[model samples]
Target: MSTRPNDTPQTLIDQVRDATASGRPLRIAGGDTKAFYGEPVAGDTLSTRSWSGIVNHEPSELVVTVRAGTPLEALEAALADKGQCLPFEPPRFGAASTIGGVIAAGLSGPARATAGGVRDYVLGAQFINGRGEWLSFGGQVMKNVAGYDISRALAGSMGTLGVITDVSLKVLPVAPAEATLVFRLGQHDALEQLHRWGGQPLPINASCWVKDATAPDAPELLFLRLRGAVAAVEAASERLMQETGGVRMDNAQAGPDWAACRDQTLPFFTPSSAELCLWRLSLPQTAPVIDLPYAQLIEWQGAQRWLWAPASAAMAIRSAAAAANGHATLFRAGADGAPGVTRFDRERSVITTITQRLRAELDPAGIFNPGRMG
Candidate 1:
């Protein structure tokens, strides 16, 4: 874990420049909280956590620009002071998770299905590319519809293209009120209800449907979060309960329940054994539940599903997901790793070609977090 001292943009630039000249690759490390994500990397460490802080925050304009190394909690606290928040509800794997890592990892939590992902809120970005040249894209203003959205493209890129230095994110005011409703139903029935509700105007913001893995015959529970105007939330709560025989969850129970799911603290995330791996499936909400030899936890109204299965079941799971017009990932693998397996879903050839071309144009030297997203 040896790393170069990079406390400023210039120092980081110098390190990257030296790496380029020496024909060496540099692994971008900000907060180092998400090291387990994606493919394991290899390169000299380029630490950016030292260069941190909020650069600009205009609460009136609902935009906050911060150094990439700024902690996610710090940014969220700042936004909370203004009664604003990141709508996508990005998760923090560690207490020191940085804004740069969040964007690079491109992961969003429960609200992602309703409010969009990291990219939607990314208004602009500044980064250092493979050639050690600083580049800027997009802007903080909402009306900035001028060019190709390179800033958004960097979201979920896993730092393969460049090293992010700063980012401009659009924020929204905190909801006036919120509530959680729970329903007990089979997986098929729960998914059907979720899709049916999607067509109507509801205050639903986030959802999770999970079954008891220990007892296959046990009933599944669906937790739905509603957030918006107080009246709307209350109205939706009453209507949903009556329609689905759902029970409203008390705040004492609701808060920790949602937090557990968002942070993967729930039992579903815990692997059963050394040979078990956590798999995440992303599919269309309309896709039906597929039969798999593993415990399943459905989320995002069925668009995102989690399972704990043996490492050898990767292909079977992926195939089932593909049949349902979705894809799967080996989110958390067992002790005996699945060697040579690409963690991410294989993309279409055209999409792969375009991605490769973009990588070549932005990181021809393959110096910035090589193979991180593959």
Candidate 2:
């Protein structure tokens, strides 16, 4: 069956209703960048490109609402104009990333440790559920809420739960000043420093790895940023230098470059045709198993890692990661290859059951994101 990217909300709903009743499963695709994120799928597809807009804006109230299909670039521009931004610093692959895509992926950057994840700032979302029935949850006002906080549940749910039409997000005023202090240390020292700062009453906005080609031993060059008043940043700078033995905060002339520290589309992303695959792993802060033929780059203060391994390395890597209390995802390479390794660290038995139940209620026909998530 063929479907046009319907423009109006009701039109989209009607389109989905008929499609679902016929036992048809709809695959919602946005921006098409994260297509490799979940299990591959071949089915009816609905594009949110037609349903785009910035429904509301209240600069004073620190919130903005937008259509699911609206590009994140547009949202950032709109917020910049208001001296405000998405405090969590969601990742954008390029110019075409959309708000809907951000929520679906449920990704957050370095600031996530300081502020919160993509779900925290979400005030509400409107979507057409798996059954093709229109469902609206949460709302625009900062504290306004739905019967259930289903709006946020939709964050990492991928599109398996619903087709997000529009969303209301809590925004933040841009920090008056920003700065970073780089610490060149090996794992033990780096983690120690990370912990030291973690215990301090300072402004450590972000931390990440900037792999240094010259030294594999010091593969991790940690970068930390500070936000807010110049004076506070200065004081934090002093405390940082004193604690880390003098690697002080410079102007961070390369602050923006550090922004790419998360969702880093490094050389890893290119040669887009490479049979190589990129996987995102979420694990416990301290996971002991560290066997890897692949290079490991981490963010979120080591809670999240991006592991690039051979397609065959999937299961071995996933097994190792699972033992360490984390999960791995086949997020890059095309799925045509027999996933030699586990595509995604299979969830725990408990989580597996819950996810199956939720999938049944959301995408009962298994129409949404077919194989990518589980």
Candidate 3:
């Protein structure tokens, strides 16, 4: 059982004050598994791993408050003991991934489309700002608020605004049952079917469509995961199989397959010799199959897509995604060191202004992980 040191908060405040006085940047870290995310940074490491533990848990109320540095796996296990879970299905890149990193990176798994994102689960947070002032926002229960919910806003901030100390999140019970199904279909048909199913009241929890160009003759595949009440899952599974001629994937295979897709451990994620960079595009779910210059694996019912392309194709790919009323992110750079590619989506002027204003107001000294999201 990890314990939050008796003076963790005050220690954090003192460290931030010293950093501010000396004008030195501080990089906030829990397990450090998500170092590759956001812009590369330089700063003195302010380790939060020791200030870790579940602060409070009320299973009846469906809320859990945990220190920022608590290992994500530990928290999940705790919730599992209660038969509840963080429905967003946050991905833990490494065994030591912490809750703080989850909120900062804001990466959710396949269930994100139907369940929710990190921000949606966030209920409250405690943090130390640039001036070494400790502050908190929101509460344990869910409710509608008139003003901005700073706790939720911190979800994807990448630690740029402040050093998060603790957070409270809403949780849900596990579904009573689950089923996985796979179908052989082309890109167009898969997209069409996914959109069609998205409109229905099915037990669909997640999906993924993959295309392998190397195996030209091999059939393209679409994988669907159904989860809910036992009756609902079985009914939906039978109906889907009947409609799409899909095979019911055995739990032995389905479990690992879904895990691989959620953690991005599939063969598609391996760097290809021809295309070295990885790109992630987020578009409307109803958008048609794009005519890009690279192969893609569509997820989130066509709302999220992943591709492998060389660095030189970044601009063209972004342009195509933009034309489709979406944005593309350079998820990974090439092994050979590619240039002129940015890692995140470019926000419009109004959104950018709001983001900047919030950052300035929260970290006025600009000492909290500078250039972290550049």
Candidate 4:
């Protein structure tokens, strides 16, 4: 079991104080597994690995508080022992991923649309702001309304707001039953089916549609997962398979496939060329097929879409996403690099002004992860 070193908090506090006094930027890192995400930050490293351990867990209360540097796998293991889980299913890009990095990245897996996102599970947090002050917001219980919004905001802040020390999150018991169904349908048809089922009282947990590249002729396939009470899952499985002419996928094969999709290890995620960049489009679930000429893997019913395109097509992709009432992000830059393409979309003036004001208030010295969100 990982243990939190007694001096870790004060050590970090002193480091932040020194950095603030000298006006030097500090890059807050935990495990460094997600270093590839967001814009690169140039600064002296402030590692959170030493402040690691589970602080509190109440099985009955369904809440766990852990030091930010605790390994994500460790926390998950502890929760599994209690038959509880983080419903958002945050992706662990690497074995060394820490809970802190999970919150900073704020990326969720397939179950996100139904189970919610990282921000939804966050109950509270403790962190060090730019003024070298240690502050805490919210509380361990869900009913604790004080400063809740601020704590939730830290979930996807990418460490630009402050150095997160620890966080409290809500957990849910593992579903009593689960199953996966496979359907051979094109993107449009699969999305239509998903939308229809989504409006019903089904146990639908996640849905993924992608072309099977390994097949003789690449055919689009939809993989759907259902989780809930045993009766609910079983009933939904039968109804979905009957209505969609889908087949049941054996858990032995389906489990790992879902995991692969979550961690982005599926064959579809593999780039065919170094110049191809991975773009993530977030649209309304009802958004129709985009007109862009690129292979896409649709998830979250239809709210999230992934495609590989060159940086040269950035404008076209962004335009299509915006036209669909959504936005596109350069999730992963190609090996050849995107000469001047920014990772995130440009926020409107109002949102930008609010973000700037928040940053100024929290990180007054601008010493923490400067330009990380851009």
Candidate 5:
């Protein structure tokens, strides 16, 4: 992949200004790895891949400022060199995944339940709004209060608000020790145990419960990851195994499995049939197992659930989510496609009004990613 030399924000500003003046909708794109995420947008492509590279790095301060189009792999490699990592573990769907796309998509990996979400690490942002004017929020330091909340809000905005030019993200040193424990338990038992452990001072960083499709009898298994000081991890691992009859996994063998879970490369993510759509249900961690009849994978200590079912099951799935005081998103359409279903759940009237007002203020012309989030 050849790098483009036009790494300055001026180039993006000029393009946005021209688009705004002509009243033409512009679809913001950085590497386009997450193009399937939201509703499709009809507009001329506005590429940000050319505006890439790290702007600054302060290892001691645990913050790195990088341009929007910088490759997510490159940023992770740089941080790894300094023994630091992004705590949220944002998923890189492919090698082409960009830092800007990570923020816009606002998706996090396995560690999300314990560490934080994409918004938590964002400290500042620079973007070109709908009018093609360069606007900035927050600052490089964590304590910079002015516009801090707004900067964080950009995470997961799906580029509907503005074209994110660059951002400063908070980083953390990698944990000293880690362990994965596996237990053969059903989904309900697994969730119950996780909830029981939640009240304890255990160093549980991530959890996943899935049925082994390849196994002879397809037993449901719970995988737990513990990360922290060496002593803490070891102690917790031993106690949990003793109490629950769990088996400790060799990191050499378990590391890649965890990565597969994070990146959704696990076999479970693959649709068994072309008609099955992928639905993501975000619920309270304490919510019980959903009574839906479909293949399911539970993550985030039960806060995030992935289910495979036909689009015809949309009403039942959405109702179940709503009953749990949560929301469901049509994460990925099946090969047959979900014709009329929206990707996102409808917000409450108040939230809908506030969202409309925010878009109106920042993207007055509605020229940026017109239908991407709708």
Candidate 6:
């Protein structure tokens, strides 16, 4: 139960440098919203809330840079005004989930494919490395040099090697419109349909599950974001409607309704009654797929899926994904059941050693997010 304090980059670097130089550990906190995202960390926590605000915003350039501690909501509002947005949808559980948290967790919503993940848009970032040195990487532009893409690498690094202070990103102009098609079908059919559509060129931003108690297969919402002129959006929607067989156009012109789909907010959060444990699985695209025991839906089929499984079957779930060349992550874990594990796909020994060395070098005293990532 580490409390939080608002601290600036200089202060954080000083603290981290001192801690690393010595042997103290400092907890990293941003919006305290994504605490459940990974394994717990020990020691006192440092909050970025105080280091807030959009450091830079160029609407014309389509790049709005901001501090890591800036509120996701604030970014959204600002981008909304400019008709631009962070392509990868990061869940804003509350004001606590800051841009830093999104980067730390590498959490992106269903709009990930066409929209891209958090790492994809990261142009440049300023952070305090473990040596406690304030460092910067990337630029305000989309393309950058090769080598260690520091900015993007930090995207899913989970704040282990360093603490993010500010980030610059290539924002996407907000789409003129979006349409959601809610199709009620068998669990198996829903997945097949989404994959079928994925192969074809359709204006789809996100394809995922909508688990409602009333309708088991209740409604599978496929989001198709349309940009450019109004006619283009309408034309794409019509083309999509024609291609989609059993899918029903729940909303031809969805406004804010699409935002509601950004999270597994409630029902999915409660794991006890909900037998389907949340597992973020990435399976083989063409494997002989078995309809997961619990309700299942596909997002970039062959790429990823947000699934629910029984806690008792954790080993089985991991095995299935492993055999199929994918991995699974436990999103919601119950008190009694072992929540799903969070290690990303396995890394080679060389990669692992390199990572461990970096972690040690950055946090020699080994304090910030000690076990959270390694």
C-alpha lDDT score of every prediction, in listed order: 0.88, 0.73, 0.87, 0.91, 0.91, 0.69
Candidates in order, TM-scores: namely 0.96, 0.88, 0.96, 0.97, 0.97, 0.86
* lDDT (tens digit, per residue) of candidate 4 on 1-374: 53443434989999999999999999999989878677889999999998889988988999999999999999999999999999999888888889999998899999999999999999998999999898889889888874337888898899999999989999999999999999999988999998998899999999999995446597789999999999999988998888889999998999899989999999988988889999999999999999988889999999999999999999999999999999999988898668699989888999889889999999999999998888
Residues 38-112, model 3: lDDT tens digits: 667799999888778998898999999999889999999999999999999888878999999999888899998
Prediction 2 TM-score vs. true: 0.88
User: What is the Å distance of residue 148 in model 3 from its true position?
Assistant: 2.3
* Model 3 clashes, total count: 0
Q: List the residue pairs that clash in candidate 5.
A: none
Write the residue-wise lDDT of candidate 1 on 53-84 in tens digits: 88888888999888888889998998998899
Go through the candidates in order and give the clash count of each.
0, 5, 0, 0, 0, 5
Q: Give per-residue CA lDDT, model 5, range 1-374, as digits (tens).
A: 22333455788899899999999999899989888898989898999898888888889999998889999999999999999999999888889999999999999999999999999999999898988888779888978875337788899999999999989999999999999999999999999999999999999999999985546588899999999999999999999999999999999989999989988999999888888899999999999989998888999999999999898889999999999999999999888669899899988999889878898999999998998888
Q: What stretches of model 4 exceed 4 Å from their correct place?
A: 1-8, 213-216
* Cα RMSD to the true fold for all candidates: 3.3, 4.2, 1.8, 1.6, 2.2, 4.4
- Comparing 1 with 6 on TM-score, the higher-scoring candidate is 1
Q: Which residues of candidate 5, in runs, are more than 4 Å off?
A: 1-7, 213-216
lDDT, residue 125, candidate 2: 83
Q: Is candidate 2 or candidate 3 better by lDDT?
A: 3
lDDT of 6 by residue, 209-235 (tens): 445544555554443444445676567
Whole-model alpha-carbon lDDT for candidate 6: 0.69
